[model samples]
Target: MEQQEVKTPEAVAMLDMLKAVPQQGKFMFGHHDDPVYGIGWDGDSARSDVKSVCGDYPAVMSFDLGRIEIYGDKNLDNVSTDRIRQEVVAQYERGGMVSFSWHADNPLTGKDSWDVSDSTVVKSILPGGANHDKFMGWLDKIADYLNSIQTADGTKVPVLFRPWHEHTGSWFWWGQNLCSTEDYKALWKMTYDRMQEKGATQLIYAYSPGTEPKDSTEYLERYPGDEIVDLIGVDAYQYDKDTFGQNLENALTIMTQVSKAHGKAMAVTETGYETIPDSVWWTGTLLPAIEKYPISYVLVWRNARERENHYYAPYPGQVSAADFVRFYEHPKTVFAEDMKQFEKKK
Candidate 1:
């Protein structure tokens, strides 16, 4: 299938790099970290640990913008917006790929991302609804932060801006049952349109569903379109040995097929075994499931210092630390040290 042409030069360059991932025989690894504020591994410390353990930092870094539109201070797991922005710019300067996911609060309920009290929240925020203007106001804050991210030389840092992720899951207010497919599509379109209008052109949209769909039809049911979405992915996690590897494998297989059909890059936007109870979960479970597909990247959850059992990646003393190190050393896994070979979008 012919790849969809990207409008922005930066996006085009990024797409090219992503498309080349499989050819390089490596997939970039990412981790979500509130590292800057010391909630996760300390600022620069996560990377330092990755380097010490695996001889390099992760090739990609992820952050959440869940609370920036609401509190402006407190956030998902108490991560500060100030620290997030700083960390984003720092990662960009270091030539690392950065991705952001929005666990946006439900506009109508004034509750968290998990709130499902208002099933029509997306409808309310669409065109001529009651909360449309208020939602746009929130988007304004998001666009402002996105536009303000830049490198030391004033280059706009490109980000894989993934919003409304895991829409197939029922845990979030924007989940499948909470909003109609049309409303979900409208939500994504409005986000892209608003951000572009606000000069946040460094953004590349990604569409991620929760689990593996039965086929492409199910996968693309709520997809905005190929033109608006640059990446296709899923958010699948492993909780036990029963469905761990099979679930991930099935999700990636679906993602690969769907991405090929639309000519978009595929990614494991979110996947990890929390606490990594299995000593060999890294190479044995995660790697085998992903290596079969041509994915651009795979991002583990995070290592929160506050929550002793909430982390996905291994620390120095964790049981899976040795296996994770082996996973990092694998020929198919790309870490921060390997990113120098890839072209960074300007």
Candidate 2:
């Protein structure tokens, strides 16, 4: 074989080390100062919103149930699919992260038994049923859509597919009282295997188990392997930040330790001061640790305050937006301060 050149010893070493290791996860987006604010607009066409607002920033964007559904009434129309694919490839060229997730209200494949909460009025539903044939068919369709948008590196862009997330709670039909433990495991494993066979290896499956004591063991109980898990994370949302703080701290600490134990990196896959005013929490408590923790990313779960939601975008007070933006994006901020000093050391 011909000799290959090395740009830098560090670069060469990093590449060689990463070669055997499946690049598990990295900071998909930067710190708050380097914020990634992509919202769930009408559908895939909401690329306009991203392009208009934070286009310059390397943000992580995503599609919702409206854009990805296949059979249900929410299925992506032919026009949306064609348009979104074009937009997605453009995003790839622009070095933006493309992601899509689902929380189906009814994951039925025509079999009633497979539908766990058939009679109950669960707020969230899985997009798939546990029946082998119906599920495989659904997975094939889903994987095909994802494969259509490969990265510039020729691999499908790694997706932050967070289905069946927050299962410790009962709001979603897949949670506590909905399905048996075995069925849940079977559902998870089958989904993983089905997606892999279809060549959508670019997916970064995030098992975002709820931040309750019971779900802690259940989270790792079915972790397929490093091959399947891209990032280990938690979806914790409640009023008491003081109470949630200890839980959040312990969760991240334990997750980081456990992930490191398995040689995987950690992330606060979904988090934010949802109802709490951004002022008290964003700067007072959250910012102090912005540079302190080993967290890879902190995605502000933006449930835009449109439909009587207090968790609206632009954050709380008018001043809060400025403070929020400055804290995350401003110079001399923790994130920026840390980076500036760290780079000088390098």
Candidate 3:
């Protein structure tokens, strides 16, 4: 791997580990909300469920920093600020990794992340725009929170910070069709620069676009640059029960090629078949889609227990429980217990 400038020793070690993943013949399995929320579970219940099924927890744990911009209370998705920091530190201590996604609400439209009502949201957040200062304030709050995440030994908990993700889709205001390429690039650069100015150096930035690209050109059409991006990935979901598998394969292939050309790590940042109605979806569909690529990690979306048909991982009695165990036991998949390999590299 070529020498690259990064913020922390953890970040440097993480890049080295990711670059060496192909030779390792394993990809870390990540679960969103595994530590914060779960299906018919939370906290230890979720971890216990994973342990009962696979005899280990997920190697990477995820949390969302959505409401931090608006509320300033660290209450995004029902997770408190203090608990989120504690969870990240705890995972780090246990030889696991942490990643965070942001679904920041539109500061101008006052709408959710999906709102593309005003295409100017991205432009407005750039330097000298209407909402530029307000957006900077939001970044400051995020920086303060990130700076506070430290382990018992006071080492910064390195985070895979994924912001402005899935931007290839037309849903978010920063989407390709909604904002100009230059405007979107400016948005990403400004956010990164502001966060750096506010002392959030422990973040490893990831650029993830929505899935199903025709070729590498489409995947890198809106790329900010290789300098500001540490990882490249795709956020694809299995919507069509039968055809989504092929789309996932195509997307991963394109992302893998592009990431390698840029000398960056790639990942399946977000993916899942909700409800997991197919008994063998884990080993049958999800595993096959990612196994061919030298990606760093594959993270499924959260399993919202309160909502029916909103989960990705199999729980105690779910139909796919047996197949999920098979997926976990696969030689190419790495769970929590297996993460010691990376920590040892550090």
- Top candidate by lDDT: 3
Model 2 ranges off by over 4 Å:
1-58, 65-67, 71-79, 82-87, 109-131, 151-155, 214-219, 289-291, 303-306, 310-312, 315-319, 330-346
Candidate 1 per-residue lDDT over residues 19-64, each given as its tens digit: 8877787799988863442224555534544555566667788888
Best by TM-score: 3
Instruction: Write down the TM-score of every candidate.
Output: 0.93, 0.68, 0.95
Clashes of each: 0, 5, 0
| Candidate 3 or 2, higher lDDT | 3
Candidate 3 lDDT over 11-67, as tens digits, reads: 677677666665687899888887666667665523645565667888888899998
lDDT (tens digit, per residue) of candidate 2 on 131-158 = 4454455577777877776545664544
Clashing pairs in 2: 32-328, 33-328, 33-329, 104-125, 305-312
User: lDDT, candidate 2, residue 207?
Assistant: 68
- The whole-model C-alpha lDDT of candidate 3 against the native structure comes to 0.83
